[model samples]
Target: GTLLTSLTEELPINLKQLDNVEKTKTALTPVFTQFQQVLEQVIAEGKFTALPLTITVEGIENYLEYRKIDFALGKQTFFSDWLPKAFIQNTAQFETVTNLSSSEVAQRIENLGSGEIKLLSVRVDSRNIVMRYSR
Candidate 1:
């Protein structure tokens, strides 16, 4: 609860009130790609089981769904449009690569180290975007 509260409070005013209709999935592609790239690096070095492949983006949270993947290679991962939209939405995650900017995402990716977190799918419901992850 505390974390969620902090996340809400820290949300950018511009995006907090912004309507999802005006947002474009293309706008989020770069941020998601950056995250994917990070995981891919881990997989290439044998740090993670495989590179995260599957990804989905939505406008609402309720539409988000999770699936079990028995893939021959790669991990699973997910991300939302909020914090990323507010910070790295149009920026480069590898550029800063620290907490100086997007602390939440930076910390999450940093913790993964050389491991790939597969994002099974993403559901963008009316409230928030939910990302699915798997080993």
Candidate 2:
């Protein structure tokens, strides 16, 4: 009860008052800061264990979902429109490298004649690439 009252006082804006995406985005920083400060205070005063504390803020999920949509739309717009224009404007600084033929690569390796060649085993998974070097 005391913590709730302290959080209520520390928060700049009431969570219930944020009706739109813009308001929620604007309040996100302050709300997060207040919650973090309150949690830190509680931990510092030895009221709760910091290691396994799970503080759930109601209605924050809605704001996070809206923000996620906003982020995706912004990313799409940036990649589709702004990035192309920027690349076109800076074309001189960017160079396109042609793919080398397998024979050409083999010839280059042959030219390096009798040197120790290290082989690498690569494994590609959905989330990561694991590469192991073999002598």
Candidate 3:
């Protein structure tokens, strides 16, 4: 496996947005493992030389500032219940803007929570670039 200098990808939503917060949070066993697998896969195969790869968020927190809500990549050997809390805490003021389709917005929300939201299309991100999911 080669040492990866950089990797780009979307950050998953928080786990608190689930309808049944406790149950959903408790049921995150598989998701955490999947996340770990993704990381391992990258480490095992990727060899990015870019100092900082650009990762665009496709959800409410498109600017990547909301990542703080997510568990630190290297922390939490068992990341079973941080996703929802992170989402609720971060994208609290999500508003749809131009350049993003309604379907895209809906997809993002869908990725975040198990419920539904009207409009379903709120894309934010103008000239300023926001790097998301950095370790």
Candidate 4:
């Protein structure tokens, strides 16, 4: 069986036109209830020892700003402490090679023998050229 499992829950809130916190909370209450129910069922089942959960609330920045929720203690801390610590496990996989020319980058890619090579990022000065290679 695969180790990773993805679950996406779409909340009924327009990210572009966000309302007050109370309204947002009210809108999310049902989805949160569903999540709670699923979690409770999982707990009752006794299927796994440790379950790593990652919740990605899209457009949360706008909502946070709209709600005037100040993260006095940095974003990373807020995410790890407040949200879920499991997120910390999701480390960046791409490798960044700085100060490389376009031809150098091409050469590097060509050298990486017969695998899927993804060009994550590329800049003019080649300051932060990120690449990910997988076999």
Tens digits of per-residue lDDT for model 4, 1-135: 112333577767788546578778877788778777776765454322322222221122233331221232123211222222211222222222123343454445445343222222232233222232221
RMSD (Cα, Å) of candidate 3? 20.6
Weakest ten-residue segment in model 2 by summed lDDT:
89-98
Q: In candidate 3, which residue ranges exceed 4 Å CA deviation?
A: 1-19, 48-135
Best by lDDT: 4
- Provide the clashing-pair count of each candidate structure: 15, 0, 9, 0
> TM-scores of the models, in the given order?
0.24, 0.24, 0.21, 0.29
Rank candidates, TM-score, best first.
4, 2, 1, 3
TM-score-superior candidate, 1 or 2: 2
Tens digits of per-residue lDDT for model 3 on 1-135? 123234344334354556776666556656676767767765443322212211123244443444332322213222111222224422332221223333433344334432222222334333212222322
How far in Å is the alpha carbon of 55 misplaced in model 1? 37
lDDT of each: 0.31, 0.33, 0.34, 0.36
Superposition error at 79 for model 2 (Å): 57
Winner of 2 and 4 under TM-score: 4
Flag clash pairs in model 4.
none
Worst 10 residues of 1 by lDDT: 90-99
Residue 96 lDDT in model 1?
13
**Residue 80, model 3, lDDT:** 16
Error of 1 at 35 (Å): 0.6
Clashes of 4: 0
